[model samples]
Target: MPGPAARDAQASGSPLIDTHGRVHRDLRISLTDRCSLRCTYCMPEQGNEWLARTSILGLDEIERVARVAAASGITTFRLTGGEPLLRTDIVEVVRRLAAVSGPDGPVQIAMTTNGIRLREVLPQLIDAGLSRLNISLDTLRRDRFRDLTRRDRLDEVLDGIAAARDCGLRPLKINAVAMRGVNDDEIVDLVEFAIAHDAQMRFIEQMPLDAGHTWDRSRMVTRDEILAALSARFTLTPVPGRGGAPAEKWALEGGPHTVGVIASVTAPFCGDCDRLRLTADGQLRNCLFSTTEYDLLPILRAGEGDDAIDAMLRSCVHGKLPGHAINDPAFLQPARGMNAIGG
Candidate 1:
């Protein structure tokens, strides 16, 4: 039997839990691999897994993982999925995660959803301790939305966004992927929608990490492009994410709210990459674009114990490269998409 890695043991009062000096302040755990729709950027339109019905992390597993993650340093956690709402007992999972208070401090509970089923479950989720929402909505045009997601029910998503606002997930965030020549035209529209809703919007640059890598850099919508487009009509002032973050943020000129830009391709933000992903099956991934991951469940489930799990995660984070070189021509996206990887 393989002995547990030395980094797994958490000393009595050691505030640091992982190798990256990361206190584990934030965690994004995937709930399922099945999604109702496959956005081009996230997965293929057809010939993909639909009945990918795996036994999602049981509620007890989620709770246990949260406890382990918190003990190591993660103070905030977000639940994601092929579409998290597709899970059978997501509300219960949120309830459990929300109940966690890390040694670093209280954990901030959040979720990243597609917004299709949000309307039906918004109230339940908010009541379960969901504090913030990051809804993926690339285009505002009804036709374009249907074309992009291959689903005609744009109204459902729109309604879901409204319901989330009504439920008071204050300052809801709208995340948009800036695809060249496709939804790029809707940047201004998305901005206006956020301003109208008093929500914070994020325009993310499509990365090479997608199956949609056949993109044209000529049409690549850089953060500068978006700022310029919005600046023509509204002045944008800078408001960086969390801690002088990479997502270049700006408030619209004369607009009531601000927007954020995620440029992972044209510009890679790997150095300050404080993000890590935990897949539905219990693999902790240090970088979304990296091919490496440390399997915690197999060992822990095999009875290696909590200290072992903690040390394993520490070695994983320590082995984590400064930042992934995803934009390089040599870069090839992992066979798995965002959904499979726990977007």
Candidate 2:
């Protein structure tokens, strides 16, 4: 991947594409295209026909992509998956990516996990140099949680979060995809839960990412709506972490820690977008809403080196849509499983 200077060059004097835009800085990588849960919003009633286990990216491939990304001025990244933890050698991948060095230095490594297998991997992952964990916990109610996630592991996830907290993982972020009349009622409760435990909570607005995600504007519990509910109990204070990333961060009124809202649907942050994504099999997606991907696997498997992958990354970033047309009534994300796309 082109370094920051080179990307800047691509965006300006030597435009990477038709326009002078060099945004897509955060690259979320999918280590595995499989998840343990079938959340109604993320999967079909009939589960996804996942890719064969052997087809997923190997550790070396993952390192190569990270090396390219790190080389290209890209420094911030997160590991996502059907469930990143489900991958057998996730710690090794984390170690390898964290090991990649840039002119400025190594990139930051983080992961979005389901938190089910977290207890088994927290210490090892911390040892591997992962700095952040975004655990998906939509509901605090056990029965409701089982109904939402379509599984029975709320206790396991909670335990995982507790274990992660104990392991000294600073800024451990808990992600809850708010659904109206479903999990929306739990917003304040969830925030309080996080406050009591001193963990950061983030309520994500359901994006129209996939039909399987069951994307519905009606279900979209907006940022204002969530914040309003929380404001009733605790005095809410805003934290200025918003820019390109999805979440708009805020600290609780009287609490010691903070919380966030990933208002992707209701409030799109496309203009400030600084993120890209790499699927496990080596397809690079520029915009989450647009399904077009530039294949890096063939280029990599063909024995092309970093330069080729870097160019591919540049092309992907260059080709990225300035902003998704999700708000348009005609907007429709392509039919691809979220797991396959590194959700």
Candidate 3:
């Protein structure tokens, strides 16, 4: 009884078109809940309790689920983690995901990494079909980097960024979480750094995802503040057609570079959000701020076919909330931190 469009939609396995018609085409998969750096905003300065090895999904499992998602209209996959590169089989992971295709053709593959170990894996990752990269660089000062991330590997990260550029990773990006009274003073410096390297810089407002539960809105820098700082030094022109993207981007007037701001706290983009997250342990998070997650490991390991997995995937997206509810007074921080949830 379905019409041609309905049949085509069903046949395509597009999960984004829920009953509410919110279509999510981007999927973020966390390879592991382990990390090399101790970023104060993401994790406690002391350390984190890592997920058990047995709990995490294998690379093959991740690939299988991703294949189904891609067939269902998921065109973008971004590998995240406490640090995804820390996984031993990361190259294979990329290789398998690179082969997945949707109605639109080959899926776009990208990653968000701390850039510590990128020096060793950048070449192989590029060869394995990684087309995009977003490296986290918080501070330009060596001492500040060490103090913030609790690691003395600033030089290594810089080298990784250079290597990523040299490897022909088109549109390499730098993500810096700007906080008031912390690294806010380095906005221009970070912008200059991105421009110098032919990379795009995105300043994200600090969110409430730290393991230490120390995110204070008072200390968080808003996008307006970031733009004000940038405007004082440079002329910025808005780039239209953000679509479901989290960052509102801009072009520096009279330059070939671009800058962006992900104002998750001050500016919410949940209405046009087109993302679904899968944690390292095979749990599906409908939203980054989702309080609950659906476990997929049991069903996956139970030898269920693609049909069953597809049903669960549909149910999860069907129940996805309209928004992340960050502005509501009732908004409670997610039980898991950003690193655990695949930031």
lDDT per residue as tens, model 2, 208-287: 75536567688788889988888887777777756666778766765477778877777778878777888888888887
The TM-score of predicted model 2 comes to 0.92
lDDT of 3 by residue, 238-298 (tens): 9999999899999998557899999998899888888999999999988899888888998
Is candidate 1 or 2 superior in TM-score? 2
> Highest lDDT, which number?
3
Q: lDDT (0-100) at residue 182 of candidate 3?
A: 79
In candidate 2, position 259 carries an lDDT of 78
Q: On a 0 to 1 TM-score scale, where does candidate 3 land against the true structure?
A: 0.96
Instruction: Return the lDDT, model 2, position 249.
Output: 74
Q: In angstroms, how far off is 67's CA in candidate 2?
A: 0.6
> Which residue pairs show backbone clashes in model 3?
13-72, 16-24
In the predicted model 2, the residue pairs found to clash are 1-310, 2-72, 3-73, 4-73, 25-274, 34-82, 41-213
Per-residue CA lDDT of model 1 for 64-104, tens digit only, reads 87887786667778889888998889899889888888665
Ranking of candidates on TM-score, top first: 3, 2, 1
